[model samples]
Target: MISKAEAKHIWVLAEQKKGKVANVALEAIGLARKLASASSQEVWAVLLGQDVGGLAEGLIQSGADVVLVVEHPKLDTFRDDPYVDVLAHLAENHKPAVFLIGANSAGRSLAPRLATKLRAGLAADCVELSWDAGNLVAVRPMYGGNVLATVTCPEARPQMATLRPKASPRPVLDASRKGRVEKVDLGGLQIRDRVKLLESVETGGGEVKLEEADIIVSGGRGMGGPERFAVVKALADAFKGAMGASRAAVDAGWVPYAHQVGQTGKTVSPKVYIACGISGAIQHLAGMRSSEIIVAINKNPDAPIFKVATFGIAGDLFEVVPLLTEAVKKEMS
Candidate 1:
């Protein structure tokens, strides 16, 4: 526990999309609450976006003791310059013991920059976070998911970490819990960058992000061709899960980058992950190795995916997936 003389708080950078709170924000707050309790500190959430007042209530309900809202018209959409500048300023001002962000696209882009600006150590894609006698310890995968590394930022103030989405449990709603809302003014420090968002295109039915999905059905090179994705999609549909792909498939242009799951792609921690026709490269396992249950289906019995799979089927995925999908559909009906 931190000494009484040293004040400590858990600060989470709450993310918003289309003026609404992102699910990753809630998950971060939930994990922050747990870390706060262990360190005998308070959990505070910081929101940066235009007209973000509506998001404060949800943050409180998600276990934040105080919601620090930084509302600026420039923050309405995600721009790297303004968001990073504001977050760095807030971290310096608040001087929280620990600062956390989601390991999603936005967070991944901003976290390392914020850490550089603050001159603080940061552990990225952390699956677990805890306080070891007042020192913030972050647990992250290393060596292509072959080993787990526990890191500590004892020398840095506002010890920073980014948690992978779905790596932690979602926070329970506590409607009765009340929290303070402090609004920060972002005045002259806004920096303009060259990148500008002209238009945003939504894809894949805008389904739940693979990182946040409870169930994911992933395809690989062995899937044969992009057309064969239908078999994988059918299984995902039957399970109401999101579809994903190995980096090999994405690089081969067999699937969109959004669907890729590997070291170079999205980190996911789903309840159940079904890998179809995937050999499970080390880079790919780095992303989804934390899944609660991994099911692998591949024609090759010697595929590397079977090593990490909780259940393995040594058969053609094309044959197996359709049968499994039909069985699931029948059960659901």
Candidate 2:
């Protein structure tokens, strides 16, 4: 068993697919950089995939001091069992002081299992992380994001946490930042495939993914019906942004569940979030309250959404959205 005293490096799991690294992975690396600096340790990024060594340079530019690349044919796709098997093996052998994972769909599934394997503690969906003395302190939202809980694992050799995407500023890529690349050999390790990935299908909705979007325009119950959602789309198109919908609009069948943004749906932290006709339910705010800029348009001046909005319009969205779209178009033109 690896002891706490032997742990030296702070590790971040740098997730990638088909040579394209996930934004959240870079964000985790950015967070890990800060913690590593505070604790006077090296920030090591562990990347797993087939033929992904070329992607290591990008992680280096994103603030990783070392990129540990583990390549295998079984890792070509993201299957829970194989991924967990490989990651757990690495954790056991290398013995990092801290392990940070992105709190996306894949990380959420992988973290708990990896923690169980290492017999360590895990903080899920953490929004903030810091080094408190020698222990890693993670802050996560609880009870529909109304409460922020602070967690720490003082005794665990490798403290682990799944950090939310867009919670931290993305590190600026610097080619001048020098880092080392190391290849991990997976010899004699029997990677188990308990679950077979039958097929992976893409669910297409819009050009920009909500999670990665810089700007988002969402509509809600005040849209009145499904056909009226065109107004919301027009505004999103004008801003070259992604389209989002409140649970009320989705439940009302105005849009697909994929576009729903709330505690029950996809969490988004866009640079600009424009809410039209959405009365800010705590569940809804829990998802997008972290957005840098929020614009709310509701006829009701007393709407809860206005409380969190950076800019609010108390008027009819049907009239207001089109005008805003035209104004944006004119500005862009």
Candidate 2: misplaced stretches above 4 Å?
none
In TM-score terms, candidate 1 sits at 0.92
Q: Give the alpha carbon lDDT tens digit for every residue of 112-195 in model 2.
A: 999998888899999899888899999998887889999999888789999998889889999999999999999999999877
What is the lDDT for 159 in model 2? 90
lDDT tens digits, residues 1-333, model 1? 222234369999889989777787789899999989897889999998888888899899999999999888778788788888888877766677888998878898999988898887899988888878878889988876788899998766778898888877888999999999998876677566557789988887778678778899999999888899999988998988899999889989989998999898877889999999889888899888989999999998999999999999999788889999999999988
| Least well predicted 10-residue stretch by lDDT in candidate 1 | 1-10
State, as a TM-score between 0 and 1, how close model 2 is to the true structure.
Answer: 0.96
Candidate topping lDDT = 2
lDDT of 1 at 120: 78
